[model samples]
Target: MTQAQQLREAILAAPLETSNFGETPQPGTLYLPLSHLKALRLDAHVVVGGRGVGKSFWTAALQSEPLRRLLGLAASELKGMEVHAGFSIAEHIDNYPNADVFDAFLAEGGDPYDLWRAVVLRWIARQAGKIIPHDSWPHTVAWLKQNPEDVARLMQQPRNWKGLILFDALDRTSADWRRMDSIVQGLLRTTLWLKAYPGLYAKVFLRDDQAERTVFNFTDASKLTATKAELKWARHDLHGLLWQRLINAPDTHGEILRDICRSTQQENVWHVAPEMKSESDPQRKAFETLAGPWMGRDKRRGVPYTWSVSHLSDGRGQTSPRSFLAAIRQAAEDSLERYPSHEYALHYESIKRGIQKASEIRVQEMAEDYPWVPKTLAVLSGMNVPMDFDIVREKWENAPAGALEGNPTRLPAQHIDRGWDGVREDLQRLGLLETKKDGRIDMPDLYRVGFGLGRKGGVKPKG
Candidate 1:
């Protein structure tokens, strides 16, 4: 095999699956974006971000002792802090209530606030070795509600260690938005309730849509909202993460890639230099080593370093690391198969094809999250964006009666009662569609290509 083929092999070994990738990311695959530092701090009560932006990743990473120690290098407050999952995708009936327990409790006219408080109280009870009701969730909640003084004494008692409680994947707690909103609001109230104790901290991971709801309408909601941190990845941060993973590939592959990128190894993990973490000449030169200088025969085609990411951004000007890394991996595979003899591991043409592959994967993730999204967006598949809203609304209205039917068991179509306008707003909020200054609708190439939408002078969707 030639050098390009070998490099492709090295790139293939990096983690590409983002959505359903295992909860605990291996230590070697870790990369910290400067923008995410505040979100990882103990005091940030609410962390919000788009899908595939590392909310779930951090939820699991914070639980690992080794990962916490590594993250501590950047945020010293995380060192030696006890982390526990109060409510997460990884459901533990003993630690917290599951969907069924929540459903049953709420069905019986139980308050979600008391249930969440019970979750924290149980964690503290275990730590303090005080026996309460261990039989079931309802039993625990009943005990807490029945004994106010006992709960207050346990909460106010000082301890030598500080604890961090995490809550994520809250959408799984309920299907309907109204119920989900109530549950979320209750959790926030409980998070505010946690503030009274100096030794305990609460961190809640929420999606942007969830944050925009009435969950924060309750008393003292601003206390948690004030400490909100958004999880974002900058352009250089994406490249930094790419090199971080590239340099840590298995065995000889790691040695070769690390040598090309010129990364630093410390504590048995590779890191991109500070200069490489920005759009410096060094960062450009590093990517050029693998994909070459220009995206085409000359500079007229634009630089591969910037073109690759710019093409993958959504309409909101946000590009998830999941999209970027997935595109690179696909590009490497395409280059190896179609242009093994090419001078670089990632050919310009192959990079374009990588965007197509990444878009397809992203659409699949959307389907899993909101099954109604694919069906609704399918109507505009062949149409071009940046067109007038009336035309799009006409298309939506002209579709079959069953086309827009929503699944209430999942996240139902947002604001369906308001008709096509509501759907338009929902899509815009999701970074899938944007309204131009003239009120024309726009879709980003990240979703446009996969969803089979057209844009003038843009990457064409597959026939």
Candidate 2:
């Protein structure tokens, strides 16, 4: 059979959970059953990370398995339990009246606190299991005016329903810092309001950088820290995922898959070694090569490599099994298409090419939309200095004198209101930039490796 057919058959034999990745499952995504909700009760948790780091997939997985297991009911069961799950409505306010009211509250503008009050009351009334009189808007407003204290008192009452409200895809919202901040604040407040109700829960998924910038306020660290879930992939966990997929492939395909894993590891190590010393040495060298150059070395000059052949290539340290599986599947498919005869060796090359292609697509697509995109990417691509807002702005402002002016480039900062902020947001969204704890930003190793950039210290200046 053709290599693609063989690989497909192998994947088919694997368990559904074993072979899928990211938010939407495909043939090779890894299913990690992380039961984190067991530690949380009566409060919301924020799951945040870079794209393809498995935030949404983890959220979906959490909601799919442990959520149902913990709550003892499916989504349908909670459908009538006075819950609402959706993305932020800040972007849609002008079009949707109900959304407009929430948007106004988020913006913290308007003298009509009563208008805001009426909106909340109506929303509560519309929630599942809520029984409010079907009065006109004016009538509802009139009633609230007279019973303001009563309405406030009712809101204070502890909710006793069992339901969860999930809000995802916040990253897709417009890149307006003020609007983004307001939305997160409004959501947090909404979560607090829901928390007062014993039976209600709210969950939001966001990127780690976005969450740091928008959600985690120093003044409210207690509130923010109390409800945070960070997504991270351990090396062993990633390895388990790869093994699971290989095992799931159909028998013959499974053998080939296993052989590929073994051969890739062996060849990668052997290709790098000056001389073979021991079996463990080959495994170590193989992992180091797969991990790329961005990984840190110890003070004593020892390299620390976490991923194995079974692990995903996380040049940026943000990849999850989903991204890994997606890359692998795409590589395999591309190989099948290009070199129909030499599927074996071609598939390996396809994996490497697929990674490079994915990174290029991310950069190119951003460049196509934002004028400054190419400059931003070029600045990132030609990394002679550490990257941050100031450096980016300096480079952008002085582009006429720099090497990039003659290139086909557009500056996104020129078109967007907050150009620097916009470029940073775009880069972060595309997984090219990551925020460190000290507020510094850096590229993921995957991007650096795919672009042929050297890692820290070991890298030399190139012309």
Candidate 3:
């Protein structure tokens, strides 16, 4: 068997742990299947990624049995650990039957630091199978209010607690945008406060946009950047994931995975047939030469390649393993639905068609929440098209004269500005855009992959 096939066989035969293949999967819901957890062991770090990238999955996977084993904790000893894993107290304050707690605390008008201390103490007490004594809680609250230094001292006392507190969905808070500054301030404060406590670590998952709007002011990039882990996919990681899924899947469908991967390489050749000019582009010639034997294509067609090699080379090829796996899952589902009886014989064309359909589905899903998705995707598709605030503003102004005639309330110019702002926010949230020192927005290599755009300084595709 070929080396690729041998690798595939080895992965298939290995015992699998998780099915999640994304950056931030939902916590307690999706499991992030990554081999890196073996490295993390019992350490704490911030996981940063866009929505649906698999942050929660990674967090949840860390709580899995294999991880606890790595950390030397028995299953029974980790009972209360799950309580510490969730978003801010605001999300779960209602679950606390003591309405008086919020009323009294808010009435006293304490800084967020004090308020968080009270809430956390109460949460911990509750998790330990004991309620905070009603009378003692008030005294503790008063003590916290009177002696902030004492509270800090008490937080330093190392307890036997051996689990992590995961703060997720910070971007999902319903707080007004104007309040973003204070909200982020409170979050960072809580992180710092929690970190001081012994045997307690907090993991705050945030999107890049939310980080900019909230956490950027309080914490320096160097400090937070070291703790930050971006949720992009590496090609080998993608391959491992696919192999794991194929191996663990029912034996009936096992061969299909290998066939699909092999066929995808073939279909890519056909799709980019026109772009393979040997004489005019020697680099293209070399790439084709390397890929030709596997791709089964001898000549360079004028058609452009769908995947960007330069971006992949820079280690930001795909947005996340989630995107790659989502595409595969969708294609597989489509194949089974279309030809259930003989899905094993699924043609390469069917999978390619499924990928196109899946891409549209993914776009539509994101667009539901983000209105400017279509335009942002269009911009990405328009390779060599410079994107800046001025360019975006011009596009809004020059939109066909009749485009905004129907909506009397929505002025074309105003709508254009809104669209630009929305796109910027959405892209930043998705980690597709980053702000430079000069405040100009730049697209990352991961974003270029879907649009077939090259990396910085790479060859631009002909329009």
**Model number with the top TM-score:** 1
Candidate 1 displacement at residue 272 in angstroms: 2.1
In model 3, what lDDT does residue 390 have?
A: 66
The per-candidate count of clashes, in order, stands at 0, 25, 16
TM-score result, candidate 2: 0.58
- lDDT of every model, 2 decimals: 0.87, 0.47, 0.44
TM-score of 1: 0.97
Worst 10 residues of 3 by lDDT: 267-276
User: Per-prediction TM-score, please?
Assistant: 0.97, 0.58, 0.58
Per lDDT, what order, best first?
1, 2, 3
- Candidate 2 weakest ten by summed lDDT: 267-276
Residue-wise lDDT of candidate 1 within 292-326, one digit each (tens)? 98988999998899999999998789999889999
Better of 2 and 3 by lDDT: 2
lDDT of 2 by residue, 1-463 (tens): 7654565445445543322122433323333323333222335456665545555554454444433333332233443344333443233332112433444444555223344345455555555345544344345656777876767765655555555656555634434445555556555555555555665566766755567664555355467467676666555444445444554465566566554444222211111111221234444443333332322233253333332222233334545555555554555566667755652422444555555555554444344434354554565554532445577567666665554332222222322456567657656665566676666666654455334444465323223
